[model samples]
Target: MRSEAASPILAFHEELASDIRTGLAGPGQKMIPSRYLYDDLGSALFDAISFLPEYGLTRADERILRTHARDIVGRLPGPITVAELGSGSGRKTRWILEAIARRGSTTYYPIDISRAALTRCALELGQLPSVRVEPIERDYLRGLSEVAARRGKSDRLLLLFLGSTIGNFEPAQARDFIREVGERLKPGDGFLLGTDLLKPVPTLLAAYDDPLGVTAAFNLNLLMHLNRDLDADFDPGSFAHEARWSAAERRIEMHLVVRRAHTVTIRGLDMRIRFEERETIWTESSYKVEREDTARLAKHGGFDCLSQWVDREWPFAESLLLRR
Candidate 1:
């Protein structure tokens, strides 16, 4: 369910095909890669989702950054490099950058998969004095690897993976991913990780399956992306958005449930994907973390949890992990 090809668009198409072929045509009922939900329109829809009152993860993380900006920045060495993975729109990032810039001039690396988003962030950050922005247009790991490879041995780097993006990965994968990040770090470097905490199921359900339907638009937009790029016939209207909390997994799952049996044709892959009535395509998972588990994972990944700042009201946490 992957592709090694280099062309961005081709690789994207191939990956989409592989996932569909594996998920839909194979053992699984159906599933789509959540990452593919970031096409231009999808990105914009997410920006809208962030603004929704029900979707408080963004605001909660922003509050934590604003309240503890200095403390968060102070934990890091001064005149350091701030690297942010999946730097969307650069709104929440400005809080971190401003805090860092107040101490001294700092380099900002905003990494993202969208070239347009990267360009926007770079242009916006460039306007800020005392901050030099170099945006990396690639997925988080590859971009982080490039930044890690280019760093000097004596560099002080504080990597930021905010907005509970870590929640997207399952537990074991989350640990392994954090370990990969730790492997890239030298002692004295730090990682600022934002994680959503387990909360009432009602709150969780509202955030994903919003009353405003913006989240639904964000989820269904994935179909539009495929329809446009892969030449697939997906009547988005035929699917309903669903958000369910899996208590055992401590995650909220987003799915698109087919209302009727139909076949989706992808011209690029020369494949037709059939779906059964009521079949669901699992789209994304947002995993909430326990405070103790976050600390344990940091230690397991070769880092010490230096500090944690939480907005107890929303129950969001921003933990600072230092490489050891």
Candidate 2:
């Protein structure tokens, strides 16, 4: 089993060792962890892709948050502390913090894996008098362990799981993530969840695999991350980004395919890997959820959906739930 105590330094060391052995030695292929895709450059590229017309998930989810933030925040019914999981750019989170502050004084908590991103968001959010931005640099999977260590107030916790990050995982994984949130939250606490609703399969596919090929570049950026972080010779030009819709899974899948047969080396790991032409490395999968499915997941994890709202234009949802 993987040790939870593996700090980023240890993780980096393991990656370096693996890369040196496999990345530089010879041509072999393996899946790269999607977690590395958000280094500064990749995060900025993702922000750009979010603005593209083809990517409607971000905008649609933002609209739901903007339109219903007040209603959702109003449901809290008491002084609240807001916690956001997987907060990327921290754009939409600002709206929620403000909304909750207006209703009652608020203390904002933004949890992310990126320390730099957290600091940037913390500095920007500090301006609001009601917003006390505590940046927690840890994976959301750990939930409140580190967060609880930092926060002693023990106030009612409200979660902001926005931008359809919930879709990034499969059903079981999503349930587990929510259950972790439930475990950390008190009975009166709430979990505000965001999800992309089921839509036309073509629409879903196009969102990840766009016509202008921006999505392609976004998908292939994984190789750039691997090369930079793991000291591996991953030629970005050698991978053609591919996206496919999995009917059984009801999600859009993103992959980076080897452009041609090749070998690469990672010096630290002393490993070499081979790739057949067109062999693909899967990167991400975003699952679409219906209201019933979303509610079921939340309820089974020890919460009941209080209210759910959808965007007027596209099928996206923001659900507010209270611990059961």
Candidate 3:
């Protein structure tokens, strides 16, 4: 059963079908928007991926939030309203919300593309005594804008972009995204940004392509997602998940490589695509950054870095930035 929410899912059937047709029929590398990877099953698979031993990103994020949530909240002025972009599961959000709730009542807006994710987030965080859980089922920017519109004159907005989801964007896109986020904020509003730091190639590779193949399953599930949602005939077995590190881009790329040549049809779109053996459909990219990069990113977004907490064990950074 689909759960109800204030905001409807933005990626409706027509928009999704259009995106799929454009991405698959494009001249360059065949691809699908990484956002499509988070259908109900994909979101659950990702939750599982976070628990894999090799994937320490989520643990690192939780550690930083737990240790510094108070300090992060303290840096902001009174009457803070929390809004988190891509608030998956939102299990790690307890630290920040608890910190805010300690002071007084607050409203928490968890914006996500997946209805299932928003539903789960509401269930997980709705129990906070002083925090009201409001789930918005929309893409990041649009959802943030809606939150911005609802902000009270005296409420300080603390935008949480945790889980290193920003790494999924290209460098330029990331900067632009941050800047756009700042546009929706008044001076003194806060932005908590999470970024995975640059680490050894082997460690990074292992994190994306875990030994137990949970990550592989997570990546492969995208095809299953498309098949189920779009009435597409994608052979999940015809392709293998591949994770590669791009030295120049400083990013880990997830791809679905075709194992054998075949043609797949999207009955809904009435389109057919021919896949050549070894051909790859680029799915997602996660760009690792240096410690200093966080501050630079904050500055680029018209925000000042108030504080940055690093997790030594995993080399992850949670930077607190103030809109300027």
Candidate 4:
């Protein structure tokens, strides 16, 4: 068991305790924070999810980056800082960094929660000529805030928040997050956002509930983490993974359904959690955004849509937002 006080990433264990205990033991529907789903194993599982044939998100975004890397880099002025939020693995970011290098040497800040991921990204990116990769080991907003404080007004920037990660936040949360980010960024700074657009229900569903079962493993890994950290007795095998589209909400929700009524105790939290047969613990929501919706969201976030790139086949987009 890792000590929460010792590990920066695991420091949120207390917060996880409160959320899971309250969410599982509270009234009505139960819920858990999707953020907790990214343990080392979960992160690896997600990487596998990216490669699954049914999952077109990674491929779609890569296509955009490959096709328009130069065009995207052209929008931002040189002697700039390229900061990426949640830059896990930094595979797609290689495209942008290559483009940035063509213009000139610039500072690269890759912010991510997993220090392991950040280290790997830095090592790979630092090898690029004239480019310095400094990674901030922190969450999204906090990392951006830190960058804003140190950077000067004259510093040009191109902030990248790719991977349709914004889709994870609820609409209101997304709006607030983007707005806060905009306040920290100066005018003329560019925000590149990759969003999974509203597509056919079947395609969206398949992406989350892939036939390869990678998504299922990813969903179940959350329980494994909870059991390990919280001293909870959770039989991950006893839970069934489920992914479905909430048409009204325009999002796909993933859940772990109880296979049988049972009680489990988290010794660390000193709580006994009970689940009725068929009860579900809602885990994640990926909200799909339309092009018009993305434009409106940028406006709410104090940005104007400068350009938008859509995948040729899939209804996925990479939109450039300029802070106004």
RMSD of each: 2.9, 4.0, 2.2, 2.4
Better model by TM-score: candidate 1 vs candidate 3? 3
Name the lDDT of candidate 1: 0.86
lDDT of 1 by residue, 173-245 (tens): 9899999999888889999999999999998999998888999999998998888876888999999999989
**Worst ten in a row by lDDT for model 2:** 19-28
* Per-candidate total of colliding backbone pairs: 0, 27, 0, 0
Summarize candidate 3's per-residue lDDT along 1-324 as a digit string, tens digits: 354443254346667888889989778799887888888888898999999889999999999999888988999868999999989889999999999999999999998888888898998899889999888878888899889888778999999999899999989999899999999999999999999999999999999998898888888999988888778899899999999999999999999999999999988788899999999999999999998998988898899999889999999999999999
Any runs in candidate 2 off by more than 4 Å, and if so which?
1-30, 152-154
Instruction: Give the higher-TM-score candidate: 3 or 4.
Output: 3
Q: Between the candidate structures 2 and 3, which one is better when assessed by lDDT?
A: 3
Ranking according to lDDT, highest score first = 3, 4, 1, 2
Cα displacement (angstroms), candidate 4, residue 106, comes to 1.6
lDDT of 4 by residue, 1-324 (tens): 657435655546667878887888889998998877877778778888999888999999999999999999888775678899988878898888888888778888898877677888888888988788888877788789878876657768899999899999999999999999999899889999999999899998899998878999999999999989888889997899999899999999999999999998888888887889999999999999889999999999999999999998787999999999
Measured with C-alpha atoms, the lDDT of residue 217 in candidate 3 is 88
Model 4 scores worst on lDDT over the 10 consecutive residues at 2-11
lDDT (C-alpha) at residue 258 in model 3? 98
At residue 205, give the lDDT of candidate 4.
88
For residues 1-324, could you state the per-residue lDDT of candidate 2 as single tens digits?
Answer: 347645754755566455444433434545554666776667677878889897888898888778877888888776788788877668888777888778656777787766677777888887876788777666675545666555547577888888787898878888887788788777888888888988998788778888888877777777776676667798988888888888888887788888899987754455577778988777777888788998899888899999998887889888898998
What TM-score does each of the candidates earn? 0.94, 0.89, 0.95, 0.94
Each model's lDDT comes to 0.86, 0.77, 0.90, 0.88
Give the Å error, residue 170, model 1. Answer: 0.9
